[model samples]
Every structure is written in structure tokens, then in C-alpha cells.
Target chain A: MIERRIQSGVGPKTGHKNEKGVGCLNIIVCIKQVPSTSNVEVDPVTGVLRRDGIKSKMNPYDLFALEQAFLLREQYGGTVAALSMGPNQAMDVLYEALYMGADSAVLASDRRFAGADVLATSYTLAQCVRKMGKYDLIVCGKQTTDGDTGQVGPEMAEWLEIPHACNAISIESFSEGAFTVKVNMDHSIYTLKIEAPCLITVDKDVNTPRLPSYLRRKRAGNAQISVWSMDDLADQAESHYGLSGSPTQVERIFPPEAHDDRECFKGSGEELADRLYSLLRQKKRI
Target chain B: MAHIEVNQKKVTPEIAERLSSVCPFGALVVGEKGLSIESGCRLCGLCLKADKDGVLTLVKDEPTVEVVKSSSRGIAVLAECMGNQVHPITLELLGKALEMAAPTGQPVFVVVIGWKVSSAVESLRCYGADKIYVYDDRSLEHFEPLRYASCVEDFVRKVRPSVVMAGATSMGRSVAPRIAARFRTGITADCTGLALREDGDLVQTRPAFGGNIMAQIVTPRTRPQLCTVRYRVFDAAQKREGPTSQVEVMEEPDGLEKAGACILEVLAKPKEPDISEAEVIVAVGRGVKDEAGLHLVRKLADILGAQLACTRPMVENGWFDPRRQIGLSGRTVKPKLIITIGVSGAVQFAAGMDKSEFIISINNDPEASIFNISHLGLVGDLYEVLPAFIEKVGREEPVR
Candidate 1:
């Protein structure tokens, strides 16, 4: 749990400001490993994705969150910790984060954490954050490519009983233990000031993520990564860890029917263009 | 505990092999117990369909939450306010909620949370809501997820509605989960379809894995089952002849002033119309290789007076704003005419614009999947085709 150390002279109406001072921000970035390719196929007869040797990589969206964390750390002297919750292989993303300049890495891996939906997954990560001790801010990608649900970050904030902002495009500045963030809300953009000890999920294209530095990788060789299981968490109840903790369940899964009824036209470009023009006019779609 | 029960007598070597192969997560194995379920099983229910001889069954322990089951009633729609007016998606959700409530005779409630939202609440009156709950205050002018969620939570706690829904907009996506988390209930995001069972359970159907498959989700054990649907998935509620809903002014919830985030300023995007509202769209994809290729497509769009859109890759490639992206993660558009150039029509992209009245696809590859969903498929290179199309459209009379 984070300590909300209210500093003197900062009025209560202005929101809580940590006593850690301005330049010593402690940030935790949550990352995930997703299937490298989006073109995963499902077997026709069995109705299951063919998962026989699919490679995995850090989620493309997470790179934005990591880059945001790095930018904050660069501007304000602070430590950026990269955290992930997945199988043992998920450490690859943590190492990738380390190579990209994260000060430390942690992984929450347990067999009991399998089959976790968004609720359970966020609960588990929140528990891990609690066990990790004090921190000012938590960062996450807008959503995962596989799940496509942008709820985990806010849900985690709920479990931590902290405030959260989503779809953040940029962190404009930090002062008095609060950060001003610009969020892209599709039709409009909001510039908001969120106090420290909160969570923010960054949208994609926030910044150009830096490539893993070879020198940094060499310097951080064999850097220890803390791995935590369910036993290591403050919440030890089995019911709140994985499948049991998840309130929503996948009742059924089926392939989307492909529409195949189409009129194919084969001709020269000019002919096709003329054909399309006339068809559009005839169909009143021009 | 929920577990898969495999009937050993019905399991043969061939059956075991088939079940094991059908298990996407490799949670099935042919072992000394004949056929066993492992920990990796996600309860996706694919193996049950694969088992021809009834060899598998999913055993779920009944939830013991009778109190919640008995208390929850009606369906509530969180009518999101855009600026001072109600968002169109809120009307769409009201339409859906009213439809779901008709058969069960359950009342449909609308919650409007915003400052100076009387006009918005007044406009919602003719939408057939049984009651419109308004949480109007000066501090609620800008959307703070926690404050907005607190207002909605107060209504939910008091009414104990069986289901609560909101639009899948940025505000909805941010606030719905927080509300759901507060109640410790399930929340499904970007649901494409919603249905209510006789037992009052909300069935939320949504696409997953980049629109590769559709999954049906249910929150049987939780009250006020939460879900969000994207815009344009359902029709907006038509206003009735006269106002019918009873308006209840709600007091601002406690701690309203202590929101975690403060909106310093709101910058409304320049009036470039959203693609979801576009009548005609000219969409390009990965096949439009370079900026030169994009230039040709842009010319075509200009000639047609159509909005220019693109697939996810084109946006990721920095060729277009993310708002112009049409896919599962982006906007869902049902334009009157959508001309897809060099697009292979990945399911994720198709899921967005498939409902368009007319689809014309131009791709060099004859086997491109874009043709499958297109009304007219041209088997030619975009480089050769776009120029001719542009020339013809420019010379012709304005269609719009």
C-alpha cells in the first residue's frame, strides 16, 4: 500500500502531495506479453486457435507506457520499475524493459494466476503492487492486444483505492506531487491534474519508444528480477486469485462468419474504373 | 470450483487425441485417467463441442448469492453527457435497455451525471425512461471518473438494478470498470450485442483476439451486471410524442469535491467529423505502400467528398490520425458507401465497417479477403485503378 504522506503548507483542498519531493518520483510501469502476430488462426474442425509455436513479444501498446515512464524519469530524477504478471516467459518483457532503462524489474507469476479475466488479473497485480511497498504512480498501456479490454488499469486503481486516468496521451508536467496529463478522449482532449499515488493508462503513439540499448543490456547483465507467487502476496485467499476471483466467464466462443458473396470484376484499370463509376451511379452511392 | 469432467468410458484413444488437439490451451491430456483436464482450461467450452460422444462436461458450483439475486431489479443506463448535450450513444443504449426491459416489464432508468445538465435530462424525458436521475453540480462539469462513478454507484446501491450499461466511449470505458470494481461485479467492454435471459442474467457478446472469434459473457452471480457497447452498434431511441419520464434531482454525493483528478482545461477537437458519422468513406490499408500511394487515395477521397479512413497498420505507420482508424480497437462505422483500397479485409477491420451499405474493394491480389465482404471487388493494382477512378469522379457531376 502506498503512503499518502501529506506535506506541510500544501493545502488539503489542493490534493495530497507526497513528502518524497519533486524530483524523486517513484513510478511503476505494468507490461504484458502478447502473441507477436495478430494473424493467429483457429482450426476449422476443432474451433481452437492453432497455438503450436507462436512467438510472443511485449504488447505494442505497453511500449508507449514504458516510454512515458522513461520520459518522466529523465525529466525528474527517479526510479522506474517494470512489472508484469504472467508465466515464467513473461520475464522476457521485464528484461526488455530493463534494457530500455528501467531501474528494476518484477514479475508476479503463479499457476494459480492462470485463467484470470480482467478483474482477477487486476486484483492480482494490485496485490503485487501492495507487496512491492511504496510507490507514487502506476502506469499501464491502454489495453492489451489479445484481450482488447482497457479495464485492468482502472480496476487495479479501484483495488488500490486510488484515482486513475485512462487514454492519456502525454504527461505535460509534474509539480507538488501531482502530474498534469493530456488525455485523448476521441472527440475531445482533456488536460487534467492528477495527484500522486494514482494510476494512468497511456494511449498508443504517446511517444516514440526508445530501442533497447546494447550498452545498457551489457551493463545490466544478470540483473536480478524479483518473482512473486500467490503466497508472496498480502492476499492469500485462493478464491480471489484466479478463476474463482473472476466474476465474468466466457460462456461460449465461436468463429465469426465470413461474408463471401461478392461480384468480382476483372478488367483493365480504366475499364474497372468506368465499371465502378457506373455501378456507383446506378446504386445511387456515387 | 469449476472443473471439466471427462467421462472415461466415452474416451477412446482417437477421442483423446481429438480432444487434446481441440484444446487451444493444451489443457486436455490423454493420461492414466484416460482423459484429464488440466489447469490451463479457460472454460472456453470448445472441447465440449469437439467431443462427439459426450465425453466432457463443465461442472460449475452454484453461486450462493441469493440475497443479491432477490434484490436486484430493472435495467439502468448511464446516460453519458457530451458537453451539455447527451451523447448519441446514450440514446442507443436507452433503446437497447427499453427493448430488453419490455418483455420482463422491468422499468428502464437513466442516470445523467454532469453540471448544467438540465437540458440533457429534459431531452432524455421523451426517450421512454421510467425515471431520469440527475446529478447536477458545478464540480461535475468536467468528467472525473471517480466522481461520476460515485454518482452512478449511489443510484446502483439504492436501486440495485439487475443490469447497468454505458457507451464504450473514453469516459464510459474509464468509469464503468471503476463502478464495477466498487461493487465487485463483472464488466464487459465493447460488447457488440446484449441479451437478457429469463433468469435476468445479461448475456454480453463481444469480439476478442482481433475479431477472430466472438465470445458470449455472462455475469450470473453479480448484480447490476455491467457492460459497454460501442456507438452505431444499435439504433438510437426515438423520442416519444410527449415527455413521460419522472425527473428526480439527486443531491451531489459526499466527497464530490475531493476527486483525484482535476480537469485544467478541455480542448474540443477541431470540427473534423468523426468517421463513425461519415456517410461515405474511402479507406486505405497496408497495400498503399508509400506516401505516393496515399496521395492517390487522398485525391480519390477529395473527388468523392468522402472521409478518408485507414486500417490499423496505416495509423500505426503514422500516415493517419488514430481517429481515422476503423477496426475493433478504433471506430465502428456504418457508412453508406465505403471504398476500400488495397485492404485485405482482416476480420478486425471488417468488424468495423461491414455494415456499410455498399463496399467496393480494389486490390491487386485476387485472393484478398477484402473481396469476401465487398459488394464489388476489382482485381487490379491500386496504382493503376485509383488514378482512373479519381479522373472519372472528378469529371463527373457531384454525387452528393
Candidate 2:
């Protein structure tokens, strides 16, 4: 129930030539709450992951990304806004971000958002960012620890109409209005430039995240967090948002059953090797 | 460019010039190539063809040429094979490299950097490497992307094997791209398949466009045809006859002296129940509904001794943790039994566990495409089948 306000109507834009050092660069980092990897347990009866009493944590990668955002804010004046979209409980990860030095946090939580896939998720997130208004740079982890597809960043970029740099190697230089980054492509490194209001994904190498500071942790530990539901966003369209908006859906789920159960590859190493050689030869691979 | 009429219409540019006093459309009334539409032809679909190419597509009642980007070059494959564990994909790459190299008759050499001089030398033979280059030093135990990159770059400078195959494990993912940066080469990641084209170029293929599209990528300009493939993409080559291994160890520490090992040492942690090894996998994704649903799925998996897993999205939502998530971002699993319920099969996840022995799928939608790769697909609710499966297996077990 704490009152949240955007400090200033418009902030100084970092990494842009026009605004050098006059005001703070309002920054937002998107984070997700995920199941705790450290204490993952499988249910014995149904072979499903046990999540009833399992703990949740800030995504493993988002911490590094938020740390990078905080460092950028420290070097240049800025406010780090950690935002997320999930159920009501997603506030926990948001709090973790706030504890790490985020100036503000937003949780777009609602029942309508359930079963939303990446494309819809990105659209919902883009709407939230638009709600956040003007900012300098947007930092996100290269990919969520769980969804490893890495489509959300590009999808968000497409929605925001901004350039997205994936797997950034280094930000050679960033000023109030200008930025230079050596981005890691599949194989090649591309040195790219985008004047303020750009999006970049941070990898483990961007910057090591710090443990929560005493002052910030103390304040955030008791901070009254704000949660917004789907109806909260004004002019929220239902045609293409959340699960209803997702074009792709999970068709089925099943366990793999072996076609040929010829498990025996009997013999010693040399003999087995010869027999394998024959099998591979029969397969026309050798 | 001039276009002539097809079928029946006939009017030459010379005839059009003579008849210019009558024609209203600006372009030449007729030419040799095909029909020339003038200003009046506002892309209206007056003319169309149903040929296989179907170059012309009717969009909004107008003929718009269907411009498509051909499924061109396969992605680059950065094969990583430089360590003590002797990465499985290293042989997968050799099989791939040999296949790719056969057309070009290019030699294959590997790069190795570990603590032991003798062991690193011997490991290459079992790996089927033509010539193994070694940079032995106690300093090179852990994988420091920056330093390890320089060492690999040093090897690239000498051996320069086309399609440098390295194991795309955690170490390879870190160092391969950095070294690729040094060579200004392209690196395709976790390629499940690789081939050399008739033109003697290495063709790398990996999942792209959100696991729905399988993209084939290739590097046209780079020298050491770089690639990085995941461990289980291809089956490891079977051990060959006695010592078919031709191995060579490189001695020049040269520029590597500056690339001092910032790494102290790498300690292999005790292995856990790797998601990749689960004989029976019951993976749940975002579709699992709620916390109660997650518990239900777990109850079913427990009865089967099956490992519980989730999609990346499910993990992001705190439905499951990283250790229990299966996909490109987590561990790649190829269990003997894989049962997916309410999970859409994405390429990233499929690549990791596509080699599973038998795949059974359960989803409400009959068109749910996981059935395409599944052995037995049931079109129904997971809630119904999961509990029944657990009961069937339970009843089958002896009273002991």
C-alpha cells in the first residue's frame, strides 16, 4: 500500500547526444519470479515437479541483469524500475529487485494473464513499459532461466519499435544520450550504437550483481509493494493480450517410449567397439 | 525491362510506337518478355497463375509478388573439443567434420588445453582427432573465457582446421564465441546437424524462429569453419580399431603467455539426477494451470519414478525451478521415457530431448503438434491420463 510516483515527468536521457549530464536516466529492468532451482524436488507418485510448498526466487539470470542496470545507474544518474508480469505473488521477485537497488517496481498480475505464452507476454510487458513512460536504456537478462527460447526480447523490441541488442559483450561507452555496445551474435561481434531509449540483454559477463545493501535491504524489506491487475492498464485491449491473444498453444504432452528396445550391446570394450562399428556401418554412418 | 503478352495478345514496341496515337496506358503496349502493365494496372488481380512457384499471391484483391527469403545457408557450427572430460559432441563433430571434410579433402586437427601433458595427448586418439594440438600448463585448469579464448585463438593461428570442432558445453559456449570474435567468424550454437555442401563449405543447422523453424546457417567468408554443437545433438562415434588415432601436440605458448590463466582450477562437482538422464520425464509448462496442478503432476510422476520437468516459460513463472526445467537454457534430456502433457513442443526443448526412446503425448486439441514426433499421442486431458497411468503402473508392480 505504499504510494508510488514517477519522480519526475520526464528524465534526462543517457546515451543520447542531446542530454549529457543534466538529469537522471529513468531505467526499467524486467524480471520474473521462478521456482527455486536450489531446492527443486520431484513428486514420486505422478512424476511431476512438486511446487505446492516449494520456494520461489528471482530468476537466476535476472540478478546479473539488474546488477548491470544498477551499475549503469550508479555511474550515470538514473532510477532502476524492476517490472514483471505474473500472478499476484510475483511481487516477491520485484521486492528482491528493489532490495538490490531498484528505485521502483511494478507487478502486472491478473488471472486473465494466465497461460500467456511468450508473444503475448511480451506484448503485455511492452504495454507496462509504455505505462512507465520515457526512459534511457532498458536492460534485461539475455533469456529467462526457464524459457531459453529468447524470443521475448525481440518481440518486445518489435512492439516498442526500438533496436534490441542480444547477448551484449560490453558497453564500450555510455553517456547521457549515446551508447556503444559490442554485442555477441551467434559467432560475430557487432559494435552497435543507439541513442538513448535502447534495449540490451545482459549475460553473466555484463556485471556481477551485488548482495543487497544494508540500507536498501532494510527499507525494501518492509516496503509496501504495489500490485496492478490486468484491468489496471487503461485502454487495455483483450483481443490480443494474455492467453487469449497467444496464437500458439501447447498441443500435447507425453513421455518418450523407445521404439526398439534392443538394449544389449554385450561384449568387452574392443569387442563392443567392433560390434558398434558394424552397427554404425549398417546405419551407413561410419 | 520490357514485357510481352502471353497466350493471345500481340503488339510489338515498334507497332506500339506506330499506334501510340490510340494507346492510353503509358508503358509499351507489348514487348518480348511478357505483358507490360501500364499506369492503369493498379496491381489488380486481372492476371494470375496457379503454377507451383505461385510467385503471384492475391492480397486484398491485388496481385502481390510473394517475395520470400530462400531457406539459405545453414547456421555456423562452432565445434568445441578441448578438455579432459573428452566431450561427447567432440566425436559427434569428428563424424560431422569428417563428413564435411570428405568433399573438400580438408585436414582435421583439434585444440586441447588442460593441466596434464600426457593425458591430453592420449585423449585425442579415442576422440578420432587427426592431429591434436596441445597447450599444456597448470595455469589452464578452469575455463576463463578471455584467457581460454586467447589460447584457442593461438591454436586457430596455427592448425586452422576448417570447422574447428569443440564441445559446446558450458566451457565451449563461453570460449567459442570469444575466439570467434578474434577470427571474426560466425558461430552457430548447439547445432543438432552439420554437413559440407558440394561447394566445400560447411553447412550448419540449428533451431531458430522460436523452435518452430529449423534454420540452416553457414559462414561464407570465414576460414576455420566455426561451429558449436550441443553434447547430444548427434550420437558419439563408436570407438574404432586399435589406435587409428593420429595425434600431434603443439608446443608454441607464444601469444598465450600474455593470456595468463586467471583461472585457479576447476573442481567437478558430484553429479546429481541430471534432467538429461531421467528415464521417464513428465514435463509441465505454462499450461499446467496452477500450484494445485503442479502438485497433481508431481503425484503422477512420483509413482512412475519419472523426473519432473518444465518448459522455460513454466520455470520463469516460478512453476518449476531451473534444475527441473528442460530446454536449451537448461539441461538437454534424452530419457527412455518422455511423457509430455499440456506442453507445446518447441524446437529448443525438442532438440534437447528429441532422442528420447518413446514419447507419449496428452493434450485436448487433436491438432496439438507434439503428436508429430510422439510415438503414441492421446487427445484428452492430462488430468485424466496421468492418474490412470500412475494407477496402471502401481497395480502392475508386485506386492513386495
Candidate 3:
């Protein structure tokens, strides 16, 4: 188990400061591995998602988030670390992150952290961040395709007692300890500035993710990727890490009832509209 | 927080082995000391159920006792708004709350947090709220996530309502979870349906695991059962003239202006016609080739006096305004007539428009999933079918 310490002094290795006099930034991009296809099945008895034969890939939204982190790292001299919480196989996404541009990777994997809901998942991620070391900023995808809650990043920010913004369209400006961003809030986009040690969940389709370099893949094949279990985290309580920590209870999950009743009308456009208008009239909708 | 206790003296190696299999979350570990409860323990009592000998007991964690203060009555609705006017979804939530309130013999309360919302009180009362709590402050003119969350959290802590409902809008999504986190309570987000059980539990039904299934979630032990209902999921509350709801002005929290982030500016997005309220809507999907195809869609909509909408991809491609997009994440429209052109109905898109009174889907792909929900399915090229439909409709009904 790796012990986490919050270093107070600046290290000689990254003593370079920006023009605004801020120390070298340490950015952590949180990613998750999700089933590639949407055809996942759930066990009715256990109420757990099944992933036996399904292939996994880095969450599609996280790609934009990593792209944003890479851009920030390029503009400012900083070290970017890829962090994730999942099973051992999640290292595949971490390895991909290494080939892309992340300086390092860490996976918080343990059997004890399984079946976590949004709250427990965010708490586990918050503990993982605390263990990974000091970070100036944390980046995450707007939401995971599998979970689709869009709540983890903000919840993690809450757990860490930091500020966070969701659906960020672009980083408008950045100084030493703060950055201004444009956030898309459905109807309106608001420009907001958040201080360092904050989190931002990037909107998908806003950035073009870079391709993994084959040269880097070959050279960094043996890159040291830290793997941490529950023992490694700051919060070692088993109850706070998994299903027990979750407050919501799922009584049942069943396939949505499908209605197969439909009518096929093969005719010219005029006949179709005539039929449609008559049908609406019959239903008294018009 | 949860409390799990095991009678170590009664636990045998076999019992420890059996305990590991009981927690689907793997919260129980079969250590050398027999069995130990982990942080992941939900206090579900499933382990006790599996162990017939009653060697285990699960209880609420005592350390966080203040979080469970006192159970209060009434159903509270978080009134969301666009400037001074209340959003329709808030009324929809109030409508559902009133329905649940009817059987429970509980009053309905509306909580409005904004500046200069006195004009909204009459509407809230008309919508069946027995009381209206308004938190009026200048700092709240624009949404700051944490500040808004803290204010609502303080209000909830003070009132201790049995249930709290919010619209699943962007602001609602941001605020509801924070309040839930503050209270350490369970929140069912984007719920499509809600019900009050005989035991006064709120059963929140929502699509889970990527819309593959609808899961019925319940906050059985938690007070102020929090839920965010999707817009248009429930009918709006009817307005009736009667005794006005009691109005109480709430003071803003002490640190309301000291949140971590600052809103640099609040620029209003371009005003577009709301398709959600349109009587007839003509929507196109990814199958449309380019701007020319979109022109045809526009012409058809013009002839039919319908609003133009599209599937999510069109919005992602910058072809349509997000306001004109129809899907689970976008606006839910239940128009009288909806014509989907070249749209293969994905489940996400179907969830938004399934309730349309009549749907006519025209696509070259006969096996398009949109056909399943469409009342009139035309299997042909939209390029061919759209122009023909426009010309026919124009000829049949000349402009007055």
C-alpha cells in the first residue's frame, strides 16, 4: 500500500514557475473504462451489471477531458496524471493514456470497491485523488456514457471541498492560480472563473482527441503505473468505499416494456399525410 | 453512514464464507478474525437475512445522528425559473407533489430561490401549494452552484420536509445532488415517475444502466426523499382561484456570496421558438445529407406551420440549435403532430417524443427503430418523400 503525504515544499525537479509566478501545475485527469457496446446485460438476481465477454474502452466523453488536459499541459509546464477507479482491466485505459500524453497513470482497483453508486464512487475517487498526491486541478468528462448521471465530478469536488463546473465548452483564459471557462448550461453558456485546486468536467465533442503514438506505446511499454487498493487510500474504512456507503437502494431493474404495436403505410407522400391528418383527427389531437 | 455489527463469537469459518456471498457489493471480508464489515456496508441487513441464526445486525450509524434530525410533514417543490417567470417543469413537479400529497394527507409547499420572485407567489399558490418559501437575494440573480446548494440545504434542514422535488433541468441537476449530498440522503435523478407507497416511501422510477431498464428506487429510511423529475414527465398543475398560500421570506445563508467559483458574466442565449410548446413539429435526423436537405425540412415545416426539430446528432453537428434537439437529454415534446424525417429512432430520442399524439416517420430504412413508435411509417427516401409531402400539403390547403 502506498502512503499519501501532502508535500508542502516545492521539489527541485519541478521548480519552474510561470510568468505569473505560480509553481509547476500538477493536473489529474479522471477516466473510467466502460463497456464499448450498449448491449450490456444485468443479472436479475444480483442486480449487478454483467461484463464477462464485453470489451471495454476509455469513456468516450473522457477523451475530450484528456484532450483538454493535454492542451493545458502543453501551454503550461506541468505533469499530467491519469487516474481511474475500476477493476484491474481498467489499466488498459491508463496504458492508452500513457501512449496519448499523460506523464503517469494510477489505478484505484480493489474487490472491496465494487458495486458503488454515484456517492460511493465519488467518495472512492476523492480518496484516490488524495492518495495520488497534490494536484492544482482535476479534469473529468461531463458524464460517463454507462452511468449517464453527470454527478460524479461535482460530487467528488464536494467531497474534496473544491469548486467544480460541468459541461465546460472551452477554457477562455488561464493565469497562475485561476482559469476562466465557458460552461454550457443547456440554454445558456456562462463564463466563470475558478481558482486552483478545482475540478471541471469537459463537454464531449468540444475537442479533437489526439491519436496514441505508436512510438510512445513501444517506448513506454514498461511505464510504471501505480496500482492502489483500499489499503492504499487515506480512507480505509471498507463500509465507506462500496455498496454499504451508497444510500440509494435499487429495488429492481427490468427491461423497459416494449410496445410492438405499429402501422406501416407504404404510399406516396400525399397519401401518407392524408392518412396522418385523418388519423390525428380520429384521435382528436388536432 | 451505516452501522454493521457481527457477533464474532458466533461466527464460524463456514459462516464467514457464507457472509461473503451475501453482500453483492463485497462489503464483507472473511478475514482470519471470522468476518469484518467494510466501509461499503449499506446496512441493508441482507447478511442478517442470509444468516438465519441472527449472528449479525445492521443499524443506522450513530455518529451522524444530527443528519436525521426530525421527520417533517408536507411535500416541498423547488421552484426553478427563467428570470422572473417560473419554468413549466416546476409546476409539473408541484402537480405530482400534490398528487402524492392527496393520499398522504400532507400539504404541498413550494420553495422559490431567486431575486424579485414575488410575482411568482400567486402562480405557485394557484398550482396547489399550501405555502411558499421565497429566498430573495441579489447574489442569487445568477446561478452559482454551491451558493444555491447551500441555501436550499439550509432551508431543507430548517423545514425538514418529508419529500423534496426539483425539475431535472441543468440548474436543478446541479442543485439537487448538492443538497442531497449535504443531507447525506438518497437522490433519484431524472425520475420519470414517482409514487407514495402505503408506508410513506417515495418510489422513484427512472431509466438506469443507459436506458436499458427502468429501475424503481426507494429511499426507505432517508427523510426528505429527494427526486428530480424530467420536464414534461408529469402533467402541469391546474390553476384555480382560492385562498393564497402562506408566504414566508427566507434569509440567504451567511456565506452565500463566498462560493469557490465566480460567474464572470451571464449572457442570454439567442431566443428561439420553443418546440416543446409547438402544436406541430417537423424533425430531421442524421440521415439528412446537408444544408440542402435541411432546407427541404424547413420548407415542409413552413407549409405545415410546424416547428423544426432534430435528433441529438444534428445538434452535435451544429446543424440545429440544442433547443431544437429532441432526446432524453434535450427537450421532451408531446406535440399533437410530429413528422420525423430520415430519423432512425434511437431509444434516447424515442424517450423524448414517445408521448406525441401522432407520429409520422419517413425513412429509407424500413427497419428503423423510430417506426416502432410511429403511428404512420413511410419506408422510402426522405429526399423523395419530403418534397412530395410539402407539395401535396401546400396544394391541399392553400394559404388563407
| lDDT digits (tens) for residues B1-400 of candidate 3 | 3456789998888888877776644568898888987644544455665787777876544332234423567789998866778888988998899899898888788999888887876567776788898888887877767777777877777887988898877787777766665655678877877898766678888776553456788876667788887787788898878746898899887766767578888777777789888989998998898888989888877766789999978987888887798876677888888989998886567768877877888887876778878878888767766676556555656632
- Model 3 C-alpha lDDT versus the unseen true structure: 0.76
lDDT of 1 at B399: 30
What's the C-alpha lDDT at position A234 in model 1? 80
Better of 1 and 2 by TM-score: 1
* Fnat for each predicted structure, in order: 0.62, 0.01, 0.43
Q: Please give, for residues A142-163, the per-residue lDDT of candidate 3 as tens digits.
A: 7786666677787777666677
Question: DockQ, per-model, please?
Answer: 0.45, 0.03, 0.30
Provide the TM-score of chain B versus the true chain B for each model in turn: 0.87, 0.73, 0.76
As a whole number from 0 to 100, the lDDT of residue A168 in candidate 2 is 68
Error of 1 at B273 (Å): 4.7
Model 1 residue B151 lDDT score: 89
Point out the worst 10-residue segment of candidate 1 chain B by lDDT.
Answer: B61-70
Q: Looking at model 2 chain A, report the run of 10 residues with the lowest lDDT sum.
A: A1-10
- Stretches of model 2 off by over 4 angstroms after superposition: A1-67, A71-140, A143-286, B1-83, B99-105, B255-257, B264-271, B290-292
Candidate 3, residue A144: how far the Cα is off, in Å: 2.1
Better of 1 and 2 by DockQ: 1
Candidate 3 segments exceeding 4 Å error? A1-23, A40-53, A258-274, A280-286, B1-72, B286-299, B313-323, B362-372, B375-395
| Interface quality of candidate 2 as DockQ | 0.03
